[model samples]
Target chain A: MRATLMYGPGDVRVETVADPKLHEPTDAIVRVVQACVCGSDLHPYHSMDATTDGVPMGHEFIGVIEETGTEVSSLANGTLVIGTFSFQDNTCVFCRDGFQTACVNGGFFGSHDVPGAQAEYVRVPFAEGSLVPVPDVSELSDLIPSLLTLSDVYLTGYHGAHMGRVEKGTTVTVIGDGAVGLSAVLASRELGAEQIILMGRHTDRTDLGKEFGATDIVAERGDEGVAKVMDLTDGEGSHVVIEAVGHMPAYEQAYGVIRPGGIISRVGVPQYEKAPVGFGSIFGKNAAVTGGPAPVRAYIDDAIPLVLEGKINPGRVFDQSVALDQVADAYTKMDSREALKVLVKP
Target chain B: MRATLMYGPGDVRVETVADPKLHEPTDAIVRVVQACVCGSDLHPYHSMDATTDGVPMGHEFIGVIEETGTEVSSLANGTLVIGTFSFQDNTCVFCRDGFQTACVNGGFFGSHDVPGAQAEYVRVPFAEGSLVPVPDVSELSDLIPSLLTLSDVYLTGYHGAHMGRVEKGTTVTVIGDGAVGLSAVLASRELGAEQIILMGRHTDRTDLGKEFGATDIVAERGDEGVAKVMDLTDGEGSHVVIEAVGHMPAYEQAYGVIRPGGIISRVGVPQYEKAPVGFGSIFGKNAAVTGGPAPVRAYIDDAIPLVLEGKINPGRVFDQSVALDQVADAYTKMDSREALKVLVKP
Candidate 1:
């Protein structure tokens, strides 16, 4: 079997690896239809932190079930499935409360012992919990874009919006233009946000933001950007703000755009630096900020239905796709900001 | 008219001062029937910041309206009233949203040009918005206690509960057992909290807390206190926590008792320092923390009505009273913890 392995920094390679067999009864094998690089993937890509050697690299994938273990009843061989990057037991106390990522026995694919999905065939554990089988598609190509997005970006974006309580008539401000930010704009629109402000510097991404329900865009950064957002919202600021970037600037920007007693749902994966924020931003303004990692499986059931029903086309953000062998090229394109999201065919 | 004036730390004096008259159309001249030493008043008394210029010190009072300006129609001359320590227009956006303390024109009396109520007569501004008239007074003696608690402690405690979202069947934890903290136990009970945990070391306060509806008491401090609270909460923590101590340790204790997605409504004045917090505590825990100096005016109307109807008896917390001539003794007794509340008659 051919699998993509990351030996070290910038060392992504397609190599012959052992075929994965059913190691656990709850595990199933899936033939990858499409997988993609994530914005979080950039952390390891550019990080100085050493990772597990001879590691499988990608996480986001939509695939067809190739084999099922004895305990896997939900996923059948040949059924198409969109697998959440993070797996969880859906009935755990935390999962039942919509915090699946923190499930008592939950695990993140590709990071721990679980092999990732950036291969022709990959092992998927807890198939019933991780895999959501989509409807049969007449054409396989049309499935790639929607399937790719459903894995992580759409659910993560939805997490941001959901945490912020973005409802109908809400004024929303998004603080990032990456894949997750664009997905949040779409999710906010889906939630019926009357006004969506996208703050970023890139014209292409900003345009994509507008297409996904951004009524206004603030190209400035930092204090200037917050001012522009405030001006656009009649000086009261947005009722809901989706903070997709976890850095200091993004935190401040999120705080700046939320009105008193408003909400800031931050889904940005914080790295080394703790965001520097004072009482003025979080307490004095009386904003409620919430969100950690998205409970993707908690959302995939509902989000998948929306995709299968064609009610929301999150695939609009996907700009390109390439053969799985060209994963390195896709990374460069995404890293260079040349593509919003690139789908990789395996 | 004679007023209680602070010459310095432990140097309160009763002396003749110019009688206050109508200062604005929104003002009324009140003959102070009773005034009380606030928990916050002891702060300046105990601190190095203690002033010595004979400043009048009390902000909490029950009084008879002696004169009214042209625009002061809500309270007639001779009407008994419980007035908020802070004056607000009540028509500003913040006041409409029920945060009268943050009102555009809101101003604290006894601090700025507005004189303290520890006098025979003092000017009350925004009279219509400031005073809540009491119609029934069969227990006129309760007036001093009711009036004493109304302006500061009771409202502050209610503010804590309100910020914590104290509602029917919710479990609430209160950190601090000063007068306001004990008052919060009462407020939480009135709000229908199913289980209440009061953190206090003193047996007297814990007994008062239990009477005020505290189902559990944690006598330990710091981590031990948190452990005690957790032991009582079945390991999940409470749905709401009220912080009434205004110290960093209390802030930390407040956060410790609340569950993920819980609320910590702080009503303490944040005396030690600006509480150090950031996006992580808020976003990661999915908690909603909202509080400030209590908007006494926002709640005074309902509270005063309750007091007048005998539905609430904040007077139980008042341990003693004295004439304005004994202002120095009042301060000394309160500073020595000899009285929970000291009501002074003018």
Candidate 2:
């Protein structure tokens, strides 16, 4: 089976690898149909150490079940499905409470131990709880791109908005112009935010953000960006600030543009371990900070119907696509900002 | 007028100060009836720089209206009232949204310009918005202590419980054995929390916490405390952790005892300017951090009824009393931990 592997920073390869096998009774073998590079992948791409045995790469994908372990009762072979980036036994206490990302029996894919989805065949653990069967969309294959986003990005954006308590009449400011940020603009709009402000320097991405329901855009960064957003919001900051860029500057912007008594929801995986949360930031303003690795599994069931009904087209984030053999170029294109996201066909 | 003044670290004085005069059309002069030393006052007491002129101290009080400026309409002379530590024009947008502490025109008492409440007379700005009138409690004088707590401590605890979303079936862990932590225990019980774990080393305070509805008490700190809490919760952690202590260790303890997807509500005035909010603390757990200065004015109306009906007795936190001339001793007692809290009569 051909799979994507990263031997070190700036190194990606599509090489023949042993096919994934069901290692547990709760596992299922998935034949990958579509997968994509994630912004988070850039973290390792920029600094991952050289290794003899490369680590499997990619967590998001939509596939068909090629085989199922004996105990996997709910799913059958050949069934089309989408799974969360992290596999969980959805019946766990945390999962039942809508926090499947923290499921006790769960673990993320694409790690050294778990073969990733960007491959010919991937093994999915906790099969019944991890995979959500999808209606056959062979005739409407265009929906595949959008549905694939539910595996991570789109639902991550939804998690940001949901955690921020975005709702009717809320003024939201989203920091970052990545696929996740754009998805947040769409999610905020879906959640009925009255005003969506996208803070991004890229006109191309900001333009898409506008189309996705951003009522305003600030191309500046730092103090200038915060001033622009405050000016747009009548000197009061937005009710909710969604941070989709995993960096210190973006997190700072989140606090800067968050209204007093409002919320700062961060879906961005932080690049640093420390941030200001004292009287000067959150305490004195009576604001709140929330968001994390999204409970995408909890939202996938609902988001699928919206995508099917044409309520959203999150797939627009995928501006480029490549075959398995061109996987290295896909990483290069995204890392160099030539593509918003690159979908890979296996 | 006799007032309490902080000359420097470890130096408190009971001095005669000029009578407070109306400085704004919205101001009202209140003759102090009962003002209490607060846990926060210890901050300035421990590190304040020496000065020729001491700073007025104290922010919690219940009193009788001495006089009112022309614009003060809702409150009348001789009417007993309780006001939030921070005066706010309750008509402001933030105030209307139940965040009076962040009101645009609001300013806290006990600051350089605003006179503190531990005086014979204090001038309150935004009188109509800041003061909540109380029914004559002369016949039921015993309720005065409890009612006075509405101005700060008790309401601050309520803010913690409210921000943490404590409700029926919630498992709560309150850190700190101070007045606010005890108040949080009471608040959580009132809010229908099924399990209340009070983490404190002081048996006297923890006993009070138990009386206030703490079902369990962990007299440990740091890792041992975290271990004890986890053991009590069957290793899942509490649904909400109310941080009533503002130090980094307390904040760390909050993260330590929080369940995945839980909330860490902080009413403690943070002594530090930064804390860990990276994946290791908040993100990985899908938890939220919220709470600030209590919008006491917003809850005063609702809380007054609870006190009047004898449903709560927050004033029990005040275990000692001092006359106007003995105000200096009050601060010393609270500072030395010889008294949980001291009530000053001026």
Retained true contacts (fraction), each candidate: 0.18, 0.88
Chain B TM, per prediction: 0.93, 0.98
- Per-residue lDDT of A128-196 in model 2, one digit per residue for the tens? 999988956652388999999999999999999999999999999999999999999999999999999
Runs in model 2 lying further than 4 Å from the true structure? none
Per-residue lDDT of model 1, residues B1-346, tens digit only: 8887765556667888778878789998888888888877776676635465666667788788889999877777888877787878888776786767756677776653787888888788888888777745532664557655888889889988987789999899999888888999999999999999999887876787888899999899899998989889887778888988777788788767677667788776665433434434444455656666777877876787677677778777777788888877777877776776777887
Deviation (Å) of A8 in candidate 2: 2.0
DockQ for candidate 1: 0.30
DockQ of candidate 2 against the true complex: 0.89
TM-score of candidate 2 chain A against the true chain A: 0.98
Question: DockQ of each candidate's interface versus the true one?
Answer: 0.30, 0.89
Clashing pairs in 1: none
The number of the candidate with the highest lDDT is 2
Docking quality tier of model 2? high
What docking tier does model 1 reach?
acceptable
